[model samples]
Target: MEISKQYAERGYAVIKKLLNQDEIEKITIIVDLIYDRWLNENGDALIEHQLINMHSLTHPRYFKNNKSERIKFFELIAPEQLTDLIEKMFGKGINFHNTQLFFNPYTNTKTPYWHRDLQYSLIEDSIQAQEQNNILSLHIRIPLIAEKGIELVPGTHKRWDSELERNVRLELNGHINSEKLPGGILIELEPRDILIFNAQMIHRGNYGLNKVRKALDLCIGKQHHLLSGFLDRDILPNDDEIRCISNNQWYVLAKDIADQNFAKEIEN
Candidate 1:
């Protein structure tokens, strides 16, 4: 299939049966090990943190320990056909920006609000800024387990408007009515299947009765160099200052009013 052309026109495409059982097992093992490690270190606190910061936690660069493992795993899979698909979408000379694992446990819970991946990045400055840099935000999701998958609004990526942005924020704040946004047209998949979409698309994590849905999510930027954004700089915090190292150059991080210390700073 001509995935690049399709993705260019439609903003998303699904590649069926990309991984064999053996490859799926390898990815499953790697993800399971990481999840175990996460539980060991943080216990239930990890889930609490996720619940408290679902929208912000989507930034993979902020996750350090998982970032290293993800980078290594991506390197192992870089030469595969998946990377070829990315090359077709973004052209040649592409490198890994960041990768993440989104595990939505199968339990009766509220569905995630519709939001764009670019909103979670440092590039969320202005509508004009988003238009200039939004194409760089490409996302690929590989379902590690079968049954549960994401729900997306097809062709929504191309409609660059302020209403979508406002809806995203309102949804995050639990103020928007679900019926107002696009709801159906879910992308369900079996194990090893992959779905690649533009990061600007309206999508939400859907967790049904399956109990646990694990997906290996990866993002690639336009530049060959690693991206320097809030996740790598502000949240991580280095040397008493938020710093981002890109192309071996250090840049000071921008202050975010949402930080935990923001309230304390105001009180003082």
Candidate 2:
């Protein structure tokens, strides 16, 4: 089957070697800078066990000054090939929904439970919002470090969980025991490999094995979908926040919705 068909059926597809070593190296530097800045600013509140944390670029201005490395990296290298594939999977135009850099640092070994992006309280109605011919959201995962990043139950995106599956999910609290469900598959990626999947898919990650597991999740959706607009509204940074990173025209649009939604609590 073709990549689009595979994604439509399985809810996920890994595109290998989508990036070269030089591109990966540059991204790694930017990721490290973001992580170090987070540590410096929030060391006291930082929880080592929660290794799958997200970060924002503080120097969007500097990065913007070097647009080829930042904005172009996302526009050309990251989503370029996936462009037609995405349109085929969802629709014609894709809107930037959310952006975040995931950090699974070394020595951290915790896994999140099996869950869908729709499970979040803020936008739990995602299923109802996704049209049969149009999807509300798609997640693009770019791995900067190699590891067993995410495991997903294939084809789970199209249906609600089975009674047994729901009960097990509730019991495990997202720490799904793959033994109980034999179909769960690990999504292992090499550096520069890309994985794009429906955000509604049943997935979990035990990131950061022996090495750090760094990835970027860029959520996008079909153009002009009301559901997409609803989800994006909750995640988009406010005008004041965007002003801080205005130099990078992309960062002005790309931002972590989780952080934006919980800005008050995160700051506190």
Candidate 3:
């Protein structure tokens, strides 16, 4: 499939019905299993109540606190057709920075704040410097259900500046109106349809009274020194133990090692 020129110029693209029914079914099954396990393990906590009230579910410490077994599973599944498309955009030898499962579970929440993913990356001290790199962080959203979908503001990625992040967050919190914000195309995504975009794009999740909406969020970037160099100078192990496992497994193991090494420095 040809990459959309519109996406190249505007910094975002959507390819509809990219995955077949079988592939979608397979992925949905795996995702459902994971979500069910997570809920079963954490059902009675105050944190669960907070999640319900927030009308969203996210593991803030997901990358930092997960077991290697789950990570391995992700790594094994990383090199599928979707990753190939990302490799086309980001070039070969890319690294998986993180993956998240976003769920808007049956609520009337308006929409999430508009912001770029780069703000949260450890590479830059501020969003301004990160933007100067022109490094594109590829985001792939695979919807698990067809009810509620995300809306993307077209061409807004090119127009985004640091100030927009603040404005968008305030707008999401009911502090201001987003009328001035650019309008986006509403995507009715089918299962496994992938929407790829740069990190700076203006986008938000629209739950719209849907009972449950889930999506797998994957972030991938090139491994060149210009981009990867900022992550930290530490060398990742390449031994059999590390290479033998899947990419997801490697992430989990890496997090465990980091936690053990930095335990005392972290405050409760």
Candidate 4:
């Protein structure tokens, strides 16, 4: 069972101990630095929104005067082992879109909910199901702290939602989004493990069990019409900065897309 095959069949794959102890320690320290800043700024808002995750980890606004820290974080994220794994998953033309940091909601009362990533977007359910196989959006999760945080429905990536799933996910009929679906598997990950899952699969972040959930997700994949225009120009590296990056393929692709999108925005 190769990784690709397993991924294609199960909609997710876990690479255990992908990062060594040293790498894990460095990431944890930097992640805590970033998380503390974000939490300090958005603690109240996280409770208000019932948000369990934060995206766009490279945004310049977060760093402000601490540009060196941002660059260091970027360098840590693009290590040779991770980059090589990403290449093996999706060879060329795959862009690193954005980064997301997953943590527990500010309040313990907020339970997790199930969803495909596109369901929150403007795209309709029918359209998303029809185009499911065409898109390749993925969440490469790097757990900075060990936890059983993620629950995913296996094989859902290859098919559309069943009626029960639709009802539970959409909260239609008498069902609620938090209601557990059949075949849902809770994923337990350690500090150094990496898990790759389809962004469009039926999944949720399990809350309350762990007081601290610090998982850094490298959102990467092919740019599609359904999932384009999200790359923020300020978050991506410029021409000079990218030169110093190790395994710069993903960042280069991301910068190109960001530049193009920025130009398009200006024109419009």
Highest lDDT, which number? 4
TM-score for each candidate, following the candidate numbering: 0.68, 0.71, 0.66, 0.95
List the lowest-lDDT window of 10 residues for candidate 3. Answer: 52-61
Task: Kindly list the per-residue Cα lDDT of model 3 for residues 29-135, writing each as its tens digit.
Answer: 65666667666666565243434221112232222354453434454336456666665665655555455676664334344445455555565534544453466
Cα-based lDDT for every prediction: 0.55, 0.61, 0.54, 0.87
Candidate 2 C-alpha lDDT tens digits along 1-268: 7877888788888888877888778767766665676677666555644546653443353354554444433443333455555666666546566566766543444545677665653644434345423554677887877868787889877876765566555554554433254478888888878898877767777653535667777766654333432443433444554454323333343444334445745687
Error of 3 at 16 (Å): 3.0
The better-scoring model by TM-score among 1 and 4 is 4
Model 3 accuracy (lDDT, Cα): 0.54
| Candidate 1: tens digits of C-alpha lDDT, residues 1-268 | 5877777667778889877787777667766675665566655665554531122222344355565544344333343667656666677544344456776643344556666665665554375244743455667777777755677776666766456546564454455624345444677778767888877677777666457777777665554111323223232323332222322111121222123235555698
Each model's RMSD to truth, in Å? 8.4, 6.5, 6.6, 1.4
Candidate 2, poorest ten consecutive residues by summed lDDT: 245-254
Top TM-score: which candidate number?
4
Clashes of 4: 0
